[model samples]
Target: DNYNAINVDRTEQIPMDYTGVMGVPITFLHKYNPRQFEIVDGLNRYTVLDVAGLNDNAVKNHLHMTEIGGKSTYFRVLIKNRKVKK
Candidate 1:
């Protein structure tokens, strides 16, 4: 998931079919439900990424640091759905 596209403000729009790791805006925590989702450390940190099994190349391609107009962007919280609706 692209951090630029998904955020807490647009949580309702998130796709339900996706089951892989996703990076979302930190604001998502405000509406977070522990029974439905699991928070994982973002790929921004080396140790966390390593523990999560995300390689450097994967991080570079998907979760690399982002900048808009020369300004760094806010952090994204990595998450995955723990229980999906059938």
Candidate 2:
């Protein structure tokens, strides 16, 4: 299955059905409200590994990784919408 990506400039398009981790542009911080969203760290390789309870030495190359349609996407800030129904 393909992953859905919301354009950074079009945040209003965020879907209500997904309550899991979302990778959004870093600039999203400007419009971010702590009450509405929860930051789940960055979407870079290092951070991704950290979140997975892994370390740098465990991985040879740490390319900034976020993917859509199995292609690498630009750097993103990992987040979860707090306002979404749980």
Candidate 3:
């Protein structure tokens, strides 16, 4: 289940300036408050991806592909904050 763990390094640096869709670590769910954020489809959800207008390349770049031991890892939960934190 480590693969599904929250990536602290990346999550800690999440930008508060953006209001659009964002990909976050699944661990974010631990502290998630539904009233504050909305869960969107993840990378594996093709239908949702199409609706979100995210292609393979865009998703890879936007998600900030990470490498572990030289292999790319995929573990994210797409989300959108109901209210952007100032």
Model 3 global lDDT (CA atoms, 0 to 1): 0.55
| lDDT of the structure predicted as candidate 1 | 0.57
| lDDT, residue 12, model 2 | 63
Model 3 RMSD to the real structure? Answer: 7.4
For each candidate, the alpha-carbon lDDT, in order, equals 0.57, 0.61, 0.55
How far off is residue 63 in model 2, in Å? 5.5
lDDT of 3 at 64: 31
Please write out the lDDT profile of model 1 over residues 1-86, one tens digit for every residue.
32332333257755566777666667788988988888866534332545445456545764444333444456666678887655
Under the 3 Å rule for N, CA and C atoms, how many clashes does model 1 have?
A: 0
For model 2, what is the error of residue 31's alpha carbon versus the real structure, in angstroms, after optimal superposition?
0.3
TM-score of each predicted structure versus truth: 0.56, 0.64, 0.53
Give Cα distance to truth, residue 27, candidate 2, Å: 1.9
Q: Which candidate is the best by lDDT?
A: 2
User: Best to worst by lDDT, what's the order?
Assistant: 2, 1, 3
Q: State candidate 3's TM-score.
A: 0.53
Better candidate by lDDT, 2 or 3? 2
